[model samples]
Structure formats: C-alpha cells, structure tokens
Target: MDNIDKMVGIRIKTRRKELNLTQKDVYAATGISNGNLSEIERGNVLPSSKALVSLSKLLQTSIDWILTGEASIIDNNSPEISNIEYGLKLNESEELIIFMLRSLPLEEQLDVKNYLRAKVAKYEKSELSSTSNHGKNVMDGNSEIA
Candidate 1:
C-alpha cells in the first residue's frame, strides 16, 4: 500500500478506537464490510472516498483529518474544526481496559465478558423499570412529561 494509504488507515483505526467502536459497529453504521474495514485499518487496501465520507460522519471527524491529519487552512478558525483532535485520542480508561483484557488468559477473558454482560443487563433492567414507572406516572397525571 502507498504511504498515504497507511496514514489514512491509521487515522481510521485511531478514530474507531477513540470512539470505543468495533469493526462490526463501524460496518453496521457505515455499510462497510467488517473484512473491508479490517483491510482498510491495516493499510492493506485504500479506502474509497465514499467510505471516508461515511467514516467521517460516523466517527465524528473530518475527511481532511483522516487523510491529511490536519484541518484544511480554510477551516482553521471554525468552531466545528475544534473537536477533531479529540477524535484521535482514546479515553485513558478505555485504553487501560483494552490493555488489561488483551493481557488476560482466554478463560479469564470469558469471565470478564460474563461479568460485563451481567452488569449491562442490570443497568438495562434498571433503565427499563425507570421508563415504565415514568410512563405510568405520566399516564396517571401524577407527573408531567418533561
């Protein structure tokens, strides 16, 4: 692959990680295949302009940043260009978690996965209970819809 292609791939991979997204997530949102996304991220294939546009929107960055690693001169003073730097940075906690997970043994990884799934289920159940109570309250005129 060309050097420019590698740079673009790095940008894509970096933004995807910063957003805590998997290739599957990016594929689902952008209609890019997971295999293609992997290839693009590895710099084994150059991304199409359309793929770059979709990725730019979904990853909340600019095509300019993805390709050239800078805001175009014309957009330097724009408020909208200010957040692009953040897109290249993964959260420290997220980076730690990924590092830890990768270091775990396979069985321990499965244990961690199970623990996270249970926690997520608990959170979802609580959210559903709260939503149901809120709906009931509104229907009974005991609470105003806000």
Candidate 2:
C-alpha cells in the first residue's frame, strides 16, 4: 500500500478505537461503505477528501489530523492531496506552510512549527512591528509566507 493509504488507515484505526467505534458505526455516520472503510483502515485503499472530512467529523478531528495523524502539523503531503480519498482545496497560506514544512527534517518540524507560531503570535500581539511588513520578502509566485 502507498504511504498515504497507510496514513489514512492508521488515522482511521486510531480514531475508531479512541471512540470505541466499530466499522459499522463509522459507515452509519459517514456514509462510507463498510468494505471501503475496512480497506481504508487496513491501508488497502485511500479515502477521498469528502471521505476524510466525514471521518474527521465522525472521529471529532480535523482533515489534517485524519490524513497525517497530526493536528495543526504541516508535512510534505499537506498540500499535495495526491492520494487523498476526497477532493478539497487548501488556502494559499496553508499550502505555503506545508511546502515549507517539507524542507525540514521530521525532528526539526516541531521547531519550525514553534517558530511559525511565534511569528503569528508576535504579529497578532503587535510585539514586533516588522512582522507587519508585506509578504514580498517571503512570497513567491506560488508560495507566500504571509
């Protein structure tokens, strides 16, 4: 199975067990067929974004959490959706954050995340006037740090 499939399956299993839910219960709430969900939970299939959203809500989680086993965490596949079982769109900043995250080692990812959080907090709190500058410094045609 593909890595994305594994991710999906792992997330599904994690959530299902966390809530003491059965595959049938998920089917009842998410409208995903039992066979499909079973395959997905076994890493035999990848779920679409719609399916991911359904599972997320049923599991009381976010799409990112369902897809990558991490909530509010960025990774290489965050923007791709190449193996997502559903179709959905990500905002530009979200996309950029994911892309940027891809360049860091897994161990360093949390550090980068902390930096990003600090940046946002600094700007939001007006603790750093420079943080209010335009995105020209960090934005490219496709990726912007703003």
Model 2, runs deviating above 4 Å? 72-146
- RMSD (Cα, Å) for all candidates, in order, is 10.0, 14.9
What are the TM-scores, per candidate, against the unseen true structure? 0.49, 0.47
Q: Estimate, for each residue in 1-146, the C-alpha lDDT of model 1 and write its tens digit.
A: 88988888998898788767788778766789999998899888988989987888667667888888895322322333334545555566666675676566434656797899999999999999999999999889898756
Q: Clashing residue pairs in candidate 2, if any?
A: 47-85, 48-85, 48-86, 49-85, 49-86
Q: List, residue by residue over 11-69, the lDDT tens digit for candidate 2.
A: 78886886677777777666898899889989988888799867765675677877766
| Residue 60 shift from truth in candidate 2, angstroms | 0.4
